[model samples]
Target: MSDSKYAFEPAQFKVICVPGDGRCLFRSVAHGACLRLGKPSPSENLQKELADELRAKVADELVKRRKDTEWFLEGDFDTYVQQIRKPHVWGGEPELLMASHVLQMPITVFMRDHKSGSLLTIAEYGQDYGREDPIRVLYHGFGHYDALDFHPSGAKSKLFQK
Candidate 1:
């Protein structure tokens, strides 16, 4: 908040707004993953690539675990699998769950709190079982998704500033 440590380095908290063009969720996930992986200011192309990779990876895992399909998809697992691989489709909490499972990481969503002028922890995606030393991603979730970042500097991050 106003502390020198926070002022000089803000890696523990940050934000990134993704395009609200229906592809925000995937873009958010991709960017978040990249940030977690230590790639500061990951490119749009790289985010898309990461999202697509996660989609395919999660989809395949679902297909293999037939029993898990009933919880995530509606009618057909095959159809769901194909759709998730597409760039245009949006992902939701279900996708996040699968992504966390596939990657074995924790995804923390920081929702904007207009009243409090701070973020509210809506949900975290790695509570299933136990995972030690997990990579973490911060997300902004409204009706859409946005990737959040942290900067270890006093100034704001140019790549993620509003």
Candidate 2:
């Protein structure tokens, strides 16, 4: 694959296959960084709702693709979510971070278990691109291993880590 294939193109969509179990690596388009529909609120529920919307968009894509492969959402938990929302609060401000010309669109899939909010893959669809966007695809296949030890397939690193 060429570099452009991995690079971001507004017209193109990127697919990241995050593994739920060790077996199937589910896929979802790497939508641009998460942005609040309104000002940030002090409610965790609000954040969760926003995340759900984003994840729903990804899920909707999965359904349209009809690939029948399980996909997942990956992120650094709430810490990262807040960080992205208000990067200035942390050392790496958003302006500076964006100045670097790369965006770390950290996303967490909204569907999750009642206990652990860690990475998860659920069934649903939310976004519709109308069949035109650059596409990025990833896959994971490790069915025999236990869930605790399972990992995403292919390169074991992040997609856009600077």
The list of candidate 1 runs beyond 4 A from truth reads 1-12, 128-142, 151-161
Residue-level lDDT for 69 in candidate 1: 57
- TM agreement with the true structure for every prediction: 0.71, 0.22
Error of 2 at 161 (Å): 19
Top TM-score prediction, candidate number: 1
60-86: candidate 2 lDDT, tens digit per residue? 443443333222223433343444343
For candidate 2, the TM-score is 0.22
lDDT of 1 by residue, 53-111 (tens): 77777777677766865665776777877887776777777777777778666765555
- Give the count of colliding residue pairs in each prediction: 0, 15
| Superposed Cα deviation of residue 68, candidate 2 (Å) | 9.4
Error of 1 at 11 (Å): 10
